[model samples]
Target: MELSRRIKSLPRYLFAELDRKKQALRQQGRELIDLSIGDPDLPTPQGIIDKMSEEIRDPRNHRYPDYEGLLEFREAVASWYWRRFGVSLDPSTEVMALIGSKEGIAHLPLAFVDPGDYVFVPDPGYPVYRASTILSGGIPYTLPLREERGFLPDLRDVPSEVAARAKVLFLNYPNNPTGATATREFFREAVAFAREYDLIVCHDAAYSELYFESPPPSFLSVEGAKDVGVEFHSLSKTFRMTGWRIGFVVGNAAVLSGLGRVKTNVDSGVFNAIQRTSIWVLQGNMDGEVEGWRQELRRRRDVMVEGLRSLGFKVEPPKATFYLWLKVPEGYTSRDFAERLLEAGVVVTPGVGFGEWGEGYVRMALTVTEGQLREALRRLREVKL
Candidate 1:
């Protein structure tokens, strides 16, 4: 059998490679404390589970779902967007339910890009952005996010010629692996940048609801943002519903329609029962419940950041998300540090797996219990830099 050229373009997924290393250590009977992935370790809200269980019994939800989604679910999404980020959306044309934000984020490139088109992606970013661009046969241009720029891409450095050929630009705030957040002013600047380039912006706001101190601002909260972009929201992190696969997109109606067109031909929509439960959670006033989750995350953040700092790693505590981005110790490359730790029964993601520029760093996810995190830190102490 022959493989497709598109399938050949992607590198091995960063997490999958890390998992292989983890499994090898497990075979040796090592007790491991893993912090390699950002999957939440918390339980889903009981109310959401009850709602889904109840809806599943109804025969109306047994058939294939609407291509767009259940109408009520779409309306709840618009209402939630307005209440959460002050971004008003039109339910009928501007919103579309996704199996998850990742599904929409990956498929969107296929809908808008041509084989020769350019796609702008942040280096040291989530692997899906670059892989999806490659799968769509689009040329990917790397935009470096240095610490001096607060880990945000500089619009001034983006060449006008590249922008002219680019079909889409991806930005993620309350970012994964890096744990960085973007400001409203930054989003406003992005809106102007996308407008000047005559291209679409794809903001991956998956971690928007997982902030520690303040809620992260949405790209759509900026004035004129709807003129050029759309934001992908996920229930995976926010609701700890990673396995449920329910999410939605809000912003530029035309771009969403294009993504919807692609989705309609590729697969079925989210299960109707899942959509109904998501709608219930959205409409129920979940502010206090979500904030409680953030409080728990904040406590975990303090423990990990302080423990690392005590061991002499110069890392700033992240204001949002549940990941820590740390520089590798002196004389050790990212992979060497990770490999050393893996042998000590602690697993982490080596940064170079994200990109060439990520070579000197490593990412630690705070998904483990405090006791486990402390155990991992103790294991690092044994490495002694």
Candidate 2:
């Protein structure tokens, strides 16, 4: 059977390919320490689990959910945003629940991009931004996030003609892979750029709550930002609720309406029981619990950073997110270095899997236990790299 053009055009997902390599090593009797994916090792907070346990038993939640999610959940989201980022949102128009932020991000291009229209995507970014743009028949214009510039895209470098032709701008702070955080000043610059180009900004703030020092600012917190774009947030990293598939997008009401329209036809909304539990968690006092999780992640980050530094790989401890983006050693390409690590029973993601510009780096996720990280370090110490 002939595959659909879109399906044929897609590259195998980065993690899926990594899983294949991991399985091959496991088959060889290697007990690998995987640092390839950023899935949290910690369990979801017990309060959220108990809330879900209670909500799931109610038969009322056994049917189709509201297309935009329950009003209570949306309100809870708005409340959480106000409390967390000091950004105001209208529950009815400015907020919409997603099965996960990935779901929302993948569908966003379909809402605004046309065939051949441009999408400004950061190179070395979350792969979904580029992949989804392709699926929607959009052209993804690469915006390299160089380390010298703190991994933030240079808006000034975007050519005038490209900006004129672009439809959407995707930005992720506390970025995946790089773990770079954005400041309000940088967001202000982005908001200005989007306004000039008449483009919709889609800020993937999934890692907003995972910081080590100062909290990251929301794009919507900048003046007139809500006039230009939306922010997609997930509970996955913040609460270690990756399995829950609960997240939301908030900002310009019209932009959200367009995304909501696409969602209504393509899929059912998030599970009602999960939505209920999300509401409970959003409204409940869980700051201390979340902070405790942050502390543990910080501990793991220090261990990985120190271990890598000892081996002569100069890696900075990221300000947020559980990832360490390190440059490959002198004689090795990203993939070659990754292959070397895999041979030593340590799995890491090759940066080139993210994009052409990611060629010289490899991203190591700090999602394993400290003991596992130490073991991975021990394994690395034996490799002659």
Candidate topping lDDT? 2
Model 1 lDDT per residue over 1-385, tens place: 8889889778766566557778877888878988887898988888788888999999999999987888899999999898888888999999999999999989999999999899999878998899899999998898887877888989889888889999999999988778899999999888998899888999999999898777889899889999999999898998889999988888999999999889999979999999998988888555677888888888888988899999999999987888998999889888888888887888888988877767888989889888898888888888856
Give all candidates' CA lDDT scores: 0.88, 0.92
TM-score, per-candidate, Cα-based: 0.97, 0.97
The residue pairs in collision within model 2 are none
Candidate 1 wrongly placed segments (more than 4 Å): 13-21
lDDT of 2: 0.92
Please give the clash total of every predicted structure, in order: 0, 0
What candidate 2 gets wrong by more than 4 Å, as runs, is: 12-21
